[model samples]
Target: MMKSLTHRRLAELADVYGGLFHLKMGQLHMVAVSTPEMARQVLQTQDNLFSNRPATVAISYLTYDRADMAFAHYGPFWRHMRKICVTKVFSRKRAESWASVREEIDSFMKNVDARIGSSINIGEMVLGLTRDITYRAAFGSISEEGREEFLKIMQEFSKLFGEFNVVDFMPWLGWISYQGGNLHKRLDRARGSLDVFIDKIIDDHLEKKRNKKNNEGFDGLEEDMVDELMEFYDENGGTSNLGSAVGITRDNIKALIMDVMFGGTETVASAIEWAMAELMKSWDDLNKLQQELADVVGLDRKVHESDLDKLTYLKCVVKETLRLHPPIPLLLHEAATDTVVDGFKIPKRARVMINSWAIGRDKNAWDEPNVFKPSRFLEGGAPDFKGSNFEFIPFGSGRRSCPGMQLGLYALELTVANLCHCFNWTLPDGMKPYELDMNDVFGLTAPRAVPLVAIPSRRLT
Candidate 1:
């Protein structure tokens, strides 16, 4: 299996080679853990030794050499960054405080309404919805001039992060791959684009802050993510009172902003798209969800955030969908030290990949693993995806678990709930439920390989 280590191929290998298997790719020693027990060992039991992330050339360059939260080395700086995100940026109060999410969803519904009776690419539309929502949350407004281009460059990051580089696996022959300089050129272009775009955003935010302080008429725009991050930065030279040995700088701010943009948009979008696709292919489940929505949030109006808690079936659909189509199928980590896990030796710096995708579909962990049954989650003792349940870790576990999970889930649940409550969907071109394509394209996130094309009819009164 040295050819390619795509999640699907690795999962297939796990079926024959067992839960934990090792592979030596050139000079790099890699391990794949696919079972719940093995995954727990890597993600929970020995979490500290595996908390660090493995960076590719593209990731290092694009994220300003791991200054970002997602790939930052596990330490005081990473912890402080994550604390800022959890407490200030993605906290429960912060998530609910954003009127941007509601505004974006409303805008999305209106667009869908306009397309009623015509075929629409649900996946593409959902991606746009998520991108706009994230943009507003991070940048205070979606009116930035380079917003679309910034998003395009961010999308390019997904491909680059997952792209194969011979230098990564075999650094001894690094010169061989660089002779053509194709990957380097691409990485340079991506980083350069981000620097120009992100620098402008930071400059604008700084100017707004300065104007607000000097009694100049401030626009009174609600403080967005950039404003919050700037609280930690000192314009003079160092950090604010929240000083750190690993000082925060402009690169740090830009990297964190990139993390928010990339992490917040595509992953949530993919989950929403998968939820809708699964519902379209499973009519009974769709009916049950819509019925729940009607009982809790009547057809007279759209779903409100307040009504989300009562939409139990809607939550189940999302959980089941994640079980099958996790945004990042392969959770990447690197060994921080030499360690023995589950009676196996894990050497220092060895690359560890936990296949949450494979584990979610494992027959041993889930009953009728391949079936899309949201009802399974309604059962007592059902596992949750909140870092504790090894069987259902869509956002992953431990320190490196997605810090934006609260915000992402809020977007996923609200968008899916509104889509189902406000409209009824059907496969286009007279396509049968079984005929709809469920294949996924693996990248930084696993989105529908073929965009889900469907027709929407107004179901609300």
Candidate 2:
């Protein structure tokens, strides 16, 4: 958020309060950590105390008591919810079933190819790519107006998140009528729309459940996860390894959907934008990657998911992108009990925020703290970085790390590989690469300040 959103302000904050310090925005208390070791211990070794976020007024209302996985505290429910999401929602098999995702990706490249011939907005293009894939994967299809409803809600959520509310800091003042507080009002409206939409899906699934009572499930496809989980509940007398998969409520479903929709779209988009920005920032490194891609794979055949196995340098670039600009720089990990990190005591109930950005750029760990170098990742096989890695963290580590890491990687690999394979992008209107503003904005994910607008030319053009 610091580097991406308001760079100088954070730089000043870092200078004033030191890299790791706490700040309160209205009622919301945030401890922004920059050092890898400190960030790591909060998320990993001494995670119990650090993971719990100090609940704010927005969270209290918006989250339905924070029952969702993203905000919920660690306990049986957290473990159980994560398990269901990993095995049932974001399963290995579920990902494999959606050939449409690849098809949509291919469509995306075509759009990019066509747009590059003209002046295209890369930001809109990438956002569309993410939005479509996310909708399809979560729900069964993307054409419905319901899909648009979800997207609209997410966009509203992002916008509202950007504006600061004084009420969040001064809860005692409570419910201030500032524009930032309007986010809560907007959220309530979003919940109404989303609830009705999700309810319709659930009702339809319930009807399916009634019809299948004596006859097993329908379509073999079972289609949506709701149906599948419902069927499983019916079959097993209502209990999963995670506990009773039985009464997964509307709120539960919505919460999970929110986590997936928001986390799914935002982070992958961040990775794509960062990769492109970095490539533009350093042409020599960018060309080296392009050379590798060209030598092994060319533009005629799109960069397929199957091709990722051989594209080592491309993987390194993606990994390095994560290192430099991890979508969630500080993963939120809670302390389960009393713990200590780097000799600092973390009492129970302390909320931990790990700073992946500072860790990635640490002089102690990386040769150059600020420079973008993909090859550095190539030094180590596969570039593993959990909370323990201390030097790098993108998808987080330990139990609370994002389950959609693979999905994000696939989207990143396929899209970025195709972009490099197809386009010869230049700063729009011949602006020098360095002139491209790398400014970013703070939110759940860090987005470019001045959007990355590049002129795309075909290999022949």
Q: Which structure among the candidates has the greatest lDDT?
A: 1
Clashing residue pairs in candidate 1 (N, C-alpha, C atoms within 3 angstroms): none
lDDT minimum window of 10 residues, candidate 1: 237-246
TM-score of each: 0.96, 0.86
Cα error of candidate 2 at position 88, Å: 1.5
Residue 440 accuracy (lDDT) in model 1: 86
Query: In model 2, how large is the Cα lDDT of residue 189?
Result: 84
lDDT of 1 by residue, 206-247 (tens): 888899999787665777888888887754425343445334
- Which lDDT value does model 1 have at 19? 93
Residue 58 error for model 1, in Å? 1.5
On TM-score, the candidate that comes out on top is: 1
lDDT of 1: 0.86
lDDT of 1 at 271: 95
lDDT of 2 at 300: 64
Cα lDDT of model 2 by residue, 359-432, tens digit: 67767777876878888877745347544576677777666677877767778888888888778888867789
Runs in model 1 lying further than 4 Å from the true structure:
1-3, 95-97, 177-180, 235-247
